[model samples]
Target: MHEAKSQNISILSYLANRFDTPVMAHIAFVGINKSFLGHYVGAHEVMHDVMTKLNGTRRLGLPSRMIDRLILVFTVSCCWLAAWLDINVLSIVESFAGPAGAIILLLLPMYAVRRVPALAPYRGRISNVFVTVIGIFTVSAIFYGLLG
Candidate 1:
């Protein structure tokens, strides 16, 4: 993250935990040693929990698809947020006013994103099933487009 100079500490930790989990999961399936498994998975489970909570907000009746779109478009246009080069953290924060600002930037379009009936299925407070599909769609799309 220092390489990109991203000021979002939460995003930074998120990137780190995302990096570790796959390796740990793979290590487990491959029957890797216990010590190595413990080091990698334990290091990231806390963050897995945090990611789960942020995702839980959709369960509170908001999937905020536009925010997801903006995030995707941001990645496509500027390269992955994680791949941005030598970005100045302070300058970025100042440009948007940091996390409070970033979140506002993220959430400003909620009224619109949740309005479509196709997406209205996502309007349920119990979005575990709906958002799971949306989540799968987003990940497959972004992952294939960006990394596949």
Candidate 2:
């Protein structure tokens, strides 16, 4: 177990050196391990748990577990389709970066400060309001540019 963990760490470190950012490094490492389908599978697991909770008593006729499995199947199919279509993934990522950056760098921190009890002391600060406005503006600008 120790040797395996060390190997994983080395791989991640190598990816970190190769990629521009830690997020990119982690994404690269994950992709290297199992290709992009790894992300979809992880998403499926999380969504499965969430759907199971939201679908109490199997409201969809099928068992709740079956619904989760169907979601996984659909997602995997879409993943394969996207792969076969040779989609320009970099372009898709670039388009989303502006809005996603704003949300991650600005909005999420402000949200945490406002909602998290541990951050209650910093709540309602002017900085939070300013940051949130900027974040919203950034997102809006990105969307507007995309649409118009």
Worst 10 residues of 2 by lDDT: 1-10
Instruction: Assess the local accuracy of residue 69 in candidate 1 as a C-alpha lDDT between 0 and 100.
Output: 52
Quote the lDDT for 110 in model 1.
39
Residue lDDT tens for model 2, 9-55: 44455656655569867776766668556776788788887777777
Q: Rate the local accuracy (lDDT) of all candidates.
A: 0.49, 0.76
- Model 2 vs. true fold: TM: 0.62
In the range 18-38, model 1's lDDT, one tens digit per residue, is: 676665555544553464367
Q: Which stretches of candidate 2 lie over 4 Å from their true place?
A: 1-33, 57-68
- Say what the RMSD of model 1 is: 19.3
> Which candidate number has the best lDDT?
2
Query: What's the TM-score of every candidate structure?
Result: 0.18, 0.62
Clashing pairs in 1: none
